[model samples]
Target: MKSVLITGASSGIGLQLASDYLENGYRVLACGLDVVKLKAVLSHPNVTHYAFDTTSVEQIDQALGQLSAPDLIILNAGNCEYVNDAQQLDAALFERVMSTNVMGTVNCLSVLLPRMQAGSHVAIVSSSVTWLPLTRAEAYGASKAALDYLARTLAIDLQDASIDVSLIRPGFVDTPLTRLNDFPMPAKISVTDASSRIRRGLERRQRVIDFPFLFILVLRIFSWLPVSWWQSIAASMRRHSL
Candidate 1:
């Protein structure tokens, strides 16, 4: 049986992916920071849980040391915090977001990459917010933008090694994470639909898995607009939110 390891399995997308993989008869190595939550999700016979903070390299190394190499590894553990007041820059908030979303993925790669061989795949969960600047997404958008670059670069670098890298950009998935959002989310999908789409995308070894087709198309189109136009739109969004 092929095995897959997923980080942030405690809740949200990670949790949904873990359950989906397990149901599909794959051996799942579920990693999460919450021990209680991790245990709850590992109720399946084919699933095993590992608790570790993704931001801590030492913790990742120690926890991952016990496991064998997996056929697939999804670095989906991330945190999102908006910059409520861009005029008053929050360096600490920016750092915290980058530390978890960017650095945490790097920490996981350091330990997991060596264990992976040819045919193994790595998936990084980014956000569609990177497509165009959104209100209050300064910290979150920046982190995901960095992840987009990282994943694209890794795709080229890992080609000869036979390890494929997939960049996943989901638009408004209904999860615990999105529940905190105060704004309206258009074309929002349930976690089950998100998981199904992700699994299917991975099975096909897609380089980029961007979801809610219409939403992504809109963003792609908007991203191609003139810089000034986009800037005006963003400014308007901020004003309305205020």
Candidate 2:
């Protein structure tokens, strides 16, 4: 049986993906910081739980060292917090968001890269925010943009190793995370749909898995607008949103 490891399996997209993969008969190593939550979300014989703080390289290395490398590894553990006041510039907030979304993924990659065998697949969960500059996405957008670049760079570097990387840029997945958003989310999809798209894309060995056709299409269209025009549009959005 093929084995897979998914971080953030305690909740949201990660949790849903864990259940789906397990139900489909894959040996799943559900990695999350909360053991109780992981168990509660995924309580199956085929699932094993590994708890670790993704931001800590020590924790990731020590935790991952205990097990054999899986055929697939999904680095989905991340956090999002918008910049409430852009003028104030919250350094701590940016650090917290970057430490988790960027460094956390790096921590896992550092350890897992050595463990990966030929034909292994690794996926990094980025956000479609990289397509267009949205209001108050300072910390969140920057981190995901870093992830997008990192994933693409790795795709080129890891080609000779026969390990594939899939960059997942999902737009507004309906989860506890998105539920906290004060603004409207267009074409937001359920966790089930997100998980299904990710699974199918990975199965097909697609390099990038961007979600919810209409949403991504709109973002792509907006991406073509000149930067000056987008700035004006974003300013209007921020005014109405606030």
Q: All predictions: root-mean-square deviation over Cα?
A: 0.9, 0.7
Model 1, span 1-242: residue lDDT tens:
99999999989999999988988999999999988889975688898889899999999999997667899999999998988877899999998999999999999999999878999999999999999988889899999999999999999999999999999999999988899988778899999999999999999999999998999999999999999999999899778767
Clashing pairs in 2: none
TM-score, candidate 2, is 0.98
lDDT of 2 by residue, 114-193 (tens): 87998999999999999999999999999999999999999999999999999999999999999999998988899999
Worst 10 residues of 1 by lDDT: 40-49
Q: Pick the lDDT winner.
A: 2
User: Model 1 Cα displacement at 4 (Å)?
Assistant: 0.7
After best superposition, candidate 2 residue 148: deviation in angstroms?
A: 0.3
The C-alpha stretches of model 1 lying farther than 4 A from their native spots are none
